[model samples]
Target: MGWFSNAPTANRIQNTNTIAACVALLEANGQVLNEVNTFASNQINRGQQLSAQAFSVQGAGSQLGRELQAAIGSLGALKTNTSQQLDELGQLCHNMELLIQQFDVPRGARTINASGRDIARVAVHDTSLVLANLLVLEQNSRPDIVRSVQTIDRADTVLNQGNANQAGLNLPGMNFRFQ
Candidate 1:
């Protein structure tokens, strides 16, 4: 019969329920973020495929050149859209991290007895550390998307250079010419 035993049991139950609810909410937010990441990844793959097709037609004549140009334009547009979506997703994840960090679980009960036996008391777990770790993981994952976008941009540059070469262009100091 310690000070904790004086607190109402109902209040202890309510505090436990609140912690469970917060865990569930955080999990839901994580799932949404995962879905957004999957979408952005798919878009990056599509852009890569389109870029490959465009580059493949670089050495062909006028007809293939026109087709390659069109493909490049389409892929560029897709990359732009995907980049925007990823930025939005990153912002959402940051907001979720902030919310999870601010969650406070109040102390409710400290002692309980079962069947006329005193159970060993354990301290309450602080979940803020776990939530902060999850936020760190989310932040770590963002760089991969950013790198993919940069890679796509580089691929675009390679395609453009190949296209220029096919058109008999040469750098100012280069002895080699496409023609």
Candidate 2:
């Protein structure tokens, strides 16, 4: 077959199939990122509430309270960063979706001059770039999630200790309970 020889319909179908597969994978990744974002937001909110409770105690300026405050602050920052990462992932997926929609399968005489290979090449490149960025997002965000969880655990422990210490003080005009 010559350079412009008749390419089989199977070639175009395979190329379109590859592009479709990449789009599906990227869309799935976007969804997972969204779920992670929601979880991080909830964790951040709880951390902030824990910080407030920590400061309400008489020993608000103590080491434990200070640690809780720091952890809560980090969680807020983590949420912000994770949101940005998720947005990037969403955009990548959206672009792939558009590309896949425009991708066409050559039929009949058009197969002789098919550009499916070129389109598939571009799709593959886009997929690779998205995959690399997704890896980075996963690697970086994992540490933040782990750290946030650990901080929450520590804050919970401190709150438990503080509440136990002040269990039955029955101070006048002051009623605070950490749950």
Candidate 3:
């Protein structure tokens, strides 16, 4: 059921198989992180375009423009956070791969003790499952997030085109962040 649960059911082969399963999960996690980064980059690009439009308009000093600027600032923060997450994920995957390699190699230069290996096995088993679940949730919710950003773009377009009375209707403040 979990990411490291692909190992053998029998006790004799459990240790080696569990290490293999952890390596598999870490590899899959790298792929998943790449996908997440692509989606995040697209969103950041959209925000950049919107920000430029907001700055270029004649109504740049208007309340709408200010709000849009703030929203885009938030988007910038999201981009920064996304970048940090990518770095962390990369480091984590690299460390885990190294650990897995060391665990499998006997008389290797970077060898971990038996107790350390046991602890790592438990940690990777639990945490990898949690990470996989969160990635799935993020993937499932991405479409909705993209559509919502598109809706915001359309609203900005209408405001810029003077199709709506910006003075009469107030745009509600909205904040979006990924947990």
Best lDDT among the predictions, by candidate number = 2
**What lDDT tens digits, residue by residue, belong to model 1 across residues 64-122?**
33443444444344445434544544554464444333322112232222211111011
- Which structure among the candidates has the greatest TM-score? 2
Candidate 3 per-residue C-alpha lDDT over 66-127 given as tens digits, one digit per residue, 9 for 90 to 100 = 55555555544544544565566666667766666655444233455443347367646654
lDDT of 3 at 98: 68
Candidate 2 on 1-179: residue-level lDDT in tens?
A: 32444344687668878777777766666666566656666666666767777778745576656765666666667567657766775776776665554453223334334366766777778777767765666666566556656767667667775543221122121111111
Relative to the true structure, candidate 1 reaches a TM of 0.37
Order of candidate numbers by TM-score, starting with the best: 2, 3, 1
Candidate order by lDDT, decreasing, is: 2, 3, 1
Model 3: colliding residue pairs = none
* Segments in model 2 whose C-alpha atoms lie over 4 Å from true places: 1-8, 105-114, 161-179
**Where does model 3 exceed 4 Å of error?**
1-12, 107-110, 115-151, 159-179
TM-score of every model versus the real structure: 0.37, 0.71, 0.57
Indicate the TM-score of model 3: 0.57
Tell how far residue 108 is off in model 2, in angstroms: 13
List of clashing residue pairs for candidate 2:
none
